[model samples]
Target: MNIFNSPQRKRLFQSMKMGWYNFAPIEEGTGIPLTDQETPYALYYCHQVLPQTIQEIQQASELVGSVLTQVWQIIRTLDEDTLLYYGFPEATIKLVKYDFLAPFCMRLDWCWNQEKGIKKVVETNPQTPSFWFECTDGNNKVARHFGLQEPDLNVQKTLKITLNQHVNRAALNLGKPVTDCRVAFTALNNAEDLGTMRWLRNYLESKSTILPLEYLGIKDGKYLFDQRTKKPIDILFMWYPVEWLIHDTDEKGERLWPALEQLIFENKIVIVNFGSAFALQPKSIFALITDLGYDFFSNKDAGTVWEYFPKTSLSATAIGNSYFAKPILGREGEGGFAVNSGKISVRSSNNDPWYTQQNYVYQELLEFPKLEIDGKSMTQVWGAWLYNNGHDKFISGGVGIRLSEGEITDNLSYWCPIGC
Candidate 1:
């Protein structure tokens, strides 16, 4: 049966367009339409995983997250020279040194080889990780359409509770009542980002405001203000990356980030994930972990690190022939290249020169297990969300799956819903 032509599929697409899932059906700026005949962002069918596999993935995700959390802790104590060695900009050094609360949410991208029983986390996004609506509500909607149970039914519920906990913690730390706190969620005025902001804002139990990044203003080099309302922002929940924020400038090309950083340093305003989250944003941390080995991690954690994390290094020659060279702070596969036998095999189609200018880390390549979906062979990358429960522990919120025909999974990759 042609699921795309089915009545149920039509209704599903219509509902998605009507904001039932808060998913952006089109890629911004490119005008590329998704969930359509050409793109098919969400597949018509569902992939079912065994319960044991789900549990294993979740367990591995949490363990890896704990290890990375320790890595962040160590990174916070490093000096400016060492941080600069790890590709951190000089503009961000002060902000990264601040001892802020744990990240509210993070996502670990993993590649699994089922036949060999191997699961490895490729990279971690501690600052901003999207696909909130697709993995939770959208996945359930697709599962129901196919008469299959959604994987992790309580994912949304757990995330909402976790978000509230983080908000309350932030408010308490600022010595402000929850009702008196003014939380502003800001993102670029793009479809995906704005939609993600709204989806997360809906989960919050307190009153919050949503605005674009451009609407933010610096007042007297002390505080950040919402230009639209001309009111001071208390707690900022932004989807903007700290790396990019440091490079942001006003219309006259004057850098506006230093003032913003000053606001954070002075405790005038607090970002949700905290500015120090940028310490873990660089891919060089992977190489650092591989280098330190037992010196940095405990005997047990060192074993886990060696087993799960691929061998990575700053020099390409350090990691033998078949490896991937990726920009330290690149997102969505930008400026990533796969080198097989000392030659570039596949490069990201969405490569941006800005990222290429940054430092690159060479990581051992892991082959992704492929599946035949709708007559197309697709490789899969599993994303696991890690939430800090405010008790010095990281918990698995849920999982999101993406599929791509290419070696590198980028923004153009299809979001494949999972069922159990």
Candidate 2:
């Protein structure tokens, strides 16, 4: 079923203003109210639970570190080319495919007071895990009780620094005389992954000059080279659709991709394209999964699980993302659907790649997990992670709660941060 098209969704949208924080609809401007009942409620709930959540996730982080250590050891012993197939160069790429830590961050968060003392993960917006819009809606509620600043994504500093290091590296590579290159930039068009892209850009541009490409027209298919000084346009940190570069083959059988490829390849413009590379997605991931277990259904094999998920309606090609529409790469929940040879198919991105022969069991739909706030259905949690180029660590950052009456987990969710 199309979760967005459901009558349930109507109820969900109606509650958007009040759902995430239990904040009153009137809390938008005029400064936060003093008697807001939502403030005490949100704090009480977070205080009661966040402490324990933090401890558990810290342990989970260590577990992931250990697992990566072992996986790296074993995988490194493989054939040279085999190692590359697993995205050794692009850590996030390999990570987005089979890892769950980054994903868990967006979905979970808590505070820890053990050896760290009041440490907390602010967010985990791993994918399109966006909250800026919701951040605006809930600002008054947060400011009233929580005392947070407006237009905040509630991101953590560790994550902010980690991402900035990458941007700074690109800037340095652009041979900056300090003022020659801008640190980061964002787009106005809010695509699916646009939220995550913006977070990193803002984080990287922290204390740096960041101008939108549209603001300067510096990105209109032009080089950064100074026509007068003969200096190429310095590093341009951008997070745009990869589609822009390859919209179509050009007049001479070339594509815009080649231009971007040249810019990036030649290091003419230092860029961090976050959209297309949100995570490591290899075309071979599905086939690699099939070799490990469950018969990854093609259009020919989709009837097997199409009923479990329905929103996925892409006509999968052999070499594109459709290949990941199987049950191995990752979890697509019960909504994403795709088309096969002659029929429609349902698949998930959360394919485990390898499972024992009898370790898995296919079951019917079970009851949905209920998470209520103030006697109303409202809330979703998105975990965030960072694949730092500097320390090369996947530091789990924060958790964002998206509120909706129906929590099937989709675009219409509301985002709220955890604390003071």
Candidate 3:
């Protein structure tokens, strides 16, 4: 049965304003396009998962969060080879020394098949995870149009609480008054990233500002500043990947690592979703934890990891012939591929260039359960945002769905709101 309504699509297009993108009408019987003119995402569908599945996902997420905390504790103890394998450059090893604390905000993406009873996590983004506005604001709009109601999880409200608490703690640690703290939320200049930063800045407590990555720089030797205003940034809410920052070079071909090192070591500025995010960004954490055995995780946490994390190996060829190849640090289905009959079948459209230089890990290839929409077979990837409030509290902010026609979810995948 088709759940899409034309009137609803018109309302979403007019009200949501997904930033200049048009949601083209979904053609009846044909699969939803990667994009459409009438909505920022494929509008005709809002996927639903069993309430039991949502409960289980939250449980698994907490377990994974605990294990990740353990991994952070032992990160420095890992041999140089293991550390380097996860893409930590030689110069950045010092940053890993402060790993007792984990990032406050995170998202875990999973491929769950109900009929086959398969639920495997693809990756975890400890620091910068998008889809907040889409999931909380846009998804709710869509749900109401479909006469659906989700229990009052209130994702955006939860995010505000998480951000407010983290910012307050950061202010305290920096010896700065929360009232005087000037925080900057920064991301790349791209539309999607900037949009996310904008959305976050709206809810951020304290005096907050938003800027593009290009406008951020180190000034006066040790202070992280906004190049646009020449003002020092007291706290930074960075959506940009930290690994890239560690490798950043100036116009003169000099690595900027020294400037960042000083800023961090001197505590000139506090960064939210701390540098520990780098340690969890790579897919190898799952592999390492699995190889290190259940000793690294509590018995229950260990079971969750084994059950939800697919067998991941550093080498793509090691996981038999029909595994999925994924960059250790890839995002948004980029640098990912599926192998069948010794041939690469599916490749991510948004594969990052940096991933080409990094190692790839292979995991067992599991198919996603399909849902028929408008006579088109569609699949979805379930993403749940896990926010650690920096106070030993793990909150499942909410869940969102990425709908796609292809085997791999990519940048253009539509946001399908989940409802009970």
Model 3 lDDT tens row, 1-420? 334446656566457655523334445555343343544564655555567877787777776677677777678677777688765666667777663345787888888787889888878887664776665666666666667766235677888888888888888888978898888998866556677788778787577888988788887676888888898899888787777777788778888878877887788888877676776777787677667776667787778778888887776666788988877777777888889878988887766687755677788788887767667777778777778766755677677777787888876676667666
TM-score of each: 0.92, 0.48, 0.87
Tens-place lDDT per residue, model 1, 207-238, is 99999888989888867889988988888898
Stretches of candidate 3 off by over 4 Å are 1-14, 20-44, 99-101, 251-253, 316-318, 341-343, 349-353
> Evaluated with lDDT, which candidate comes out highest?
1
Give the alpha-carbon lDDT of every model.
0.80, 0.37, 0.73
Q: Alpha carbon lDDT of residue 420, candidate 1?
A: 78
List, in order, the clash count of every candidate structure: 0, 41, 10
Model 2 alpha-carbon drift over 4 Å, by segment? 1-48, 58-129, 132-155, 175-180, 190-233, 241-245, 248-255, 273-368, 387-389, 416-420
Candidate 1 lDDT at 275 equals: 70
**Candidate 3 TM-score over all chains jointly:** 0.87
TM-score-sorted candidate list, best first = 1, 3, 2
